[model samples]
Target chain A: MSGNILEVSGLTKTVGGGKKIVDGLSFDMKKGEILGLLGPNGAGKTTTIRMIVGLMSKTDGSVTINGRDLDEQGKACRANIGAIVENPTFYEYMSGYKNLKLWGRMAGGSVTEERISEVVSLVKLEDAIKDKVKKYSLGMKQRLGVAQAILHRPSLLILDEPTNGLDPKGIRELRDYLRELADEGISTLVSSHLLSEMQLMCDRVVIMEKGKVIDISDLSSLNAYGDKDQVAVSISVKKGQGEAAKTAVSVLEEVTVASHETENELLLDMGRDRIPELNRVLVKAGIDVFGIESKRTSLEEKFLQLTSGKADKEAN
Target chain B: MFALLHNEWSKLWNKKQPWIFIGILIVISIGTAFLYTAFDTLEGAGTEGDGENWEVTLELENEQYAQTIAESDDEWEREFAQDRIEENEALLAAGVDPNETNNAVFLNEMIYVGTAFITLFAVILASTIVSSEQDKGTLKHLFVRPYERWQFLVAKFITVILFAAVMLVTVTAVQYLMGTIMFGTGSFSTPVVEYGMGGVITTTVAEVFPQKIGLYFLNMLMFVVISFSISILFKSQTLAVGIGIFILFGTNILQGFAPLLQDYFWYPYVFLPHMTLQSYVVTDEFIPGVGLGFSLAVLAVYAVLFLGAATAFFQKRDLV
Candidate 1:
């Protein structure tokens, strides 16, 4: 049950003019894992997602979902996956309920009346389900989108930029729903440039840039990235003692000076267990430690450690 | 497959376009019935004898037509006189008077009228089905499901054909009822005039009804195939519908230019001139040499080509 749910190997999409919109890229998701494709706009995150879901053709590479090859067993492979690409669009003239029922019919009878009601309730769209989608708000549409994607009980769910237009509360609720789905052993591949939302939603993040995956880091627990078990500790000292603090902690083996925040402050990347030892060395150097705080592990910390590139892309 | 068709059918009726089209058809049908009544009365004006002595009047007209048929040197003029004489003889032999207004005559006149409108609506439906989904961004949802890309195309194609069939039948039904209500019920065995190989022909309304409807349906289907595939292959819905309308009305307009252009090798091969397939019910020859089978085969080949190109382009298109 814990094996890989989706494996995309060397997936590529070359558009007209012979330019590759999505270069050869590969990534995988374990069963029940929440994987995030983190990238700025124009990074080909959407293109890669489209190729996996069969919305677009791949110039090269293979995708296997639930042990079925996507190219060889397209229908069988799609049966196991549900998706929300960018904004969800339903028939504007139809009620939300009818829209779901239409999709239910397309799912080949796997979606029952009970299942429809259950999914509607899961997204808390019970009240608005009977209303036409043309009358729905953006937030309500997003909720219905989630309901539509998960209606068939697909083993794998893919959402591209699910947080594009959601409010803070709506995004939090979506995060909660996704985590709840993960608890039920359903895997999700969510793509977004909203690093902070991905921070709270995904169990792992695959950072992409310019149609290529640059890094894949585990974010389920604190700091499972470069230098395992390490944390970013910022030690603020007396104005003149910053240099002395630096010289004093130079003797430590596992600690690296991460970055300097101010003239009187220094940031250190060291093992969590070595925090006290490094603090003692600074005090032993006749430096008064004014504020010594260990920062919580986050994607922000990883972005700083991995690359100096822009971390958060606020794309629409 | 049932589910897919049901979904398509629901989508078509759920929108406002079909309702508006139906409403307009009803209004126009009623208007045409009244217009025809007015014209019928105007032509038979000012004389009670004109209404009562139609048999003597037709005999006199037939004698003149017979003289033209025997004396006219022009081949088309001779054919025209021959057509008129035979048409009057059929009515006289059937003992049906032309001055008598009846539902059968109304139906016989209007049966093929609504097909132009039906083809218009079908073209609109077929042109918009796929492209509208793409415009709304829901096409990717359709493609990502557990169905092949061509299944959606096939479903849409079938849906358009069904729509055309329904419209054709519905419009005819409405016309028949209006005719019955406006005029007196007439015999189905009333002689209907038609043009055939080298001469005019006459058959009963009951005999020609099915042939006219069936041939027109086949013609409209070819229209749907061309427009549906164009919309799928191209991104612009307007261009597809435009081409469809051009093919619809252009068939008649281009015929005025046919004599000047008929010498070209490509003229007979052009499917536009052959689109009026219902004419085949009256005559085997479309032009000098083209027959019903050859025209049908040409239309089928064009349909396959348009649909093939559309499916190929659609299957590979990146919906992003």
Candidate 2:
């Protein structure tokens, strides 16, 4: 009765030559929480979700659902979860409704006729619900994927890249549906490489880099996280005074010269507030300041810097 | 387990392949009956007694067969004549009409023939039943449910066995209908002729067919088990199906090699020779003392081994 619907601790997966593709991932989801797993490609989000849902075996560590250990009570543990691993594929020869009934039957036969129609129309699939899945477009298939994941009203919903191949409207509708489900006290774990989407959909986000959780943070300062940790504020004094600019900024306590981008421009690794401090030193040194320009504020660039480790250390 | 079985059964009937398989079976059953009727008059005229004087006609055919056996030097032709002569003498001694072809006779003969098609379709069905789910990317969805991996597999195994049984029942029913339409229904107790190690044997359809169909059904169950195991264990669907069909037809080819290989100590243990367990009904022994019990035992051992490997592999396999 921890009230955490899903708990994963030190979960690891190793491939050939003992390479840990997913290493030491520990996270927990509370009741009615919308937790997003945010990582770049190859961050092991799918691998972790697969292990939690029993699609793949874990080489080490444990996953517990609804206070039930996965090893001791796997069926009971899985009964609490509904997942769409990677992309959802259905029995294409069957109608969408029949496919739902098939999945509903597999969930210990508790899904009712009313629940079937409720999920169908909840996903707005009532129009083509009787048609074969083969005829449904990618967007329709995505919607049906949502329908099947919620058919049994599982307490834990795991969707790996559920927004893949979805339009903007579809994505928005899915976000709204997830919020509605969250209002009903069903915890959901959604993984995506898209940071903005995660920011919009998740109540909390766990950022991963290189098969490990680099940082866990709320939505407010995540944009700030990208900026502060990046190699920002590349300064260009006089063409000849680049050397002097480096010499003058050496007086500062926490400055490190990041890179020598050009003969005249010295890329400085320091916080944004210290830009004026270095400017004062350069002016005192009697060097003509050509210009002090920080790198452009693109989130993806900052994210790359974040995953590449510079932003992480700054945040820590 | 029942819920899993219901899910699998629903998914199976939702496809088109099983329906097409049963459709072809009905057409073949009806078509073969009409084809047999086209040559019925020729066969009646050859005996010179039609259907009513079947006992007298057997005597005339036996006299003609004796002359043919004496004049023929080719081994097959001589054996054929000698065999028919023994069959006629056995039927006459038993007072059973040899020329009575009716619903019971048609059913007895055609049930095994239709099951050959059943065996083929069942092998194909079992081969693709699991691997097709893998190919279609729906397998991972099943893995996430509130059931063990082995439960899904066992459900599929039972489904295929059920499918093969349903095909057998349906094919027999359709063949019986066609038989009644063409030749009329005869006594289920009508005597039929069979060749055995001790010469021709006389038995009734009622006395013989239960054993035949029962043995056939058991043998067909082994076929389904083998193919279903191979389907789950192997990665490639086409290769799984190819090996399944190869094993199905390969049993007959192995029958040709049985006599040569019988001297080997391991020959009896190999499952191929035992695949035709129905053959043991007429002959008391396949060779000297090997019989239905030995074949059944060998098949049971093999079925356990095949399914053991499949279940072990399926339980540990990580669906990527």
- Would you estimate the TM-scores of all the predictions? 0.90, 0.86
Q: Which sections of candidate 2 miss by over 4 Å?
A: A223-302, A309-316, B69-77, B196-198
Q: Tens digits of per-residue lDDT for model 2 on A133-191?
A: 99998889988999999999999999999898889998998899899999999899999
Tens-digit lDDT track for model 2 on B1-320? Answer: 99888988988998999999999888888887887777776676676785678888888889898999889888899899988888888888988775678999888866777888998999898889899999999999999988889988999989999998889888889989999989898989988876666677788889888988899988888888888888888866797789888988899999888879999999998998888878766877887778888889999999999999999999999999
Q: What's the lDDT for all of these models?
A: 0.85, 0.85
Could you give me the TM-score of model 2 versus the true structure? Answer: 0.86
lDDT value, candidate 1, whole model: 0.85
Cα-based lDDT at residue B60, candidate 2: 86
Clashes of each: 0, 0
Highest-TM-score candidate: 1
At residue B196, give the lDDT of candidate 1. Answer: 62
Ten residues in a row with the worst lDDT in model 1 chain B?
B43-52
Q: Native contacts retained by model 2, as a fraction?
A: 0.95
